[model samples]
Target: MDHVDRTEIRPCRAADLPLLDRHLPTPGAPTRHADRFARQEAGTGTYLLAWRDGVPVGHGQVRWDGCAAPGVRAAVGECPEFNGLDVRAELRGQGIGTALIHAAEELTRERGGTALGLGVGHDNPRAAALYRRLGYGPVVAYTDRWSWTDPDGRTHEEADPCTFLVRDLTTPDA
Candidate 1:
């Protein structure tokens, strides 16, 4: 189990908040991750970071909730055992997204999670391809709230902006 150089993924700490937020959903907006980091710090969730030469280049967060997306009912946020991977946009490719996801899955499995989950913008076909290539599969069709203060922090909780995904972390074989 040897990983590559130039970028290493690790568990996130309080001191890494600023670094994590840098590649997070929003630019120059710590408020975007305010709610998420608070819970992770409070022991309700976990955040993973991807670093290059001690510099934070990517980040992902895992939570014990379901359906974080918006406009979906009944199944959105239903299960409490699943985890989510909220990564940064700046490092979407270059293996950063996949590395961060693998790191988060490790942390989630260590935390007793059997299933891994995440949501991506419906229009982001590139992201969809990336996730699919990394072993993630779509379970349900859903959306996220687009606002001025969400992870991307624009200020509009628009409806159905993304798709829901859940991957089996146990079966590493496809």
Candidate 2:
């Protein structure tokens, strides 16, 4: 927790690709970081990183257009969606993920959002508990579906059962 106190959260920069590749390589989705950066540049989303001792440790994405998941869109309207949160395997439980989520929440609030949404996979009770502790409440149950291109350019699809959640950013604790 003390180290988490020293963690810095900020938007992903062009120079971070290599650093991210070294520490957080998404081999199955080789161009993920670049694509997120492009979304950031396009003003449709934000890619945030958490740095500790000058090394990247965690990351998250905020889609300003809300979640593309149909159930989420239907349930939550257009509130910003916080997704793709990940922390270094060795750094889990150290608060890096929480810091990243806090940063994403602030980014949403700063952008005039009254609320923010996220999805917790049904099989991930740990994450569900964390989000619940963070004040996010379940909104809808849906299949979280998406596809990603592998390094070889083969596309793979995923459909995980999930519960969409939303938090009221207007509240002080949020």
User: Can you give the TM-score per candidate against the true fold?
Assistant: 0.75, 0.95
- Write one digit per residue (lDDT tens) for candidate 1, span 50-123: 77767776666676654555433355444332233444455555677777777777776776777777777788
By summed lDDT, the worst window of 10 consecutive residues in model 1 runs over 78-87
lDDT of 1: 0.63
Compare the candidates by TM-score and give the number of the best one.
2
Expressed as tens digits, the lDDT of each residue in 45-160 for candidate 2 is: 99999998888888889999989988788888888999989998888998888888888888888888889889999999989988999999999999998788876888899899
What TM-score would you give candidate 1 relative to the actual structure? 0.75
The reply for model 1, stretches above 4 Å from the true place, is 1-3, 20-25, 69-73, 76-92, 149-155
Each candidate: RMSD: 4.2, 1.3
The TM-score of predicted model 2 comes to 0.95
Error of 1 at 73 (Å): 7.2
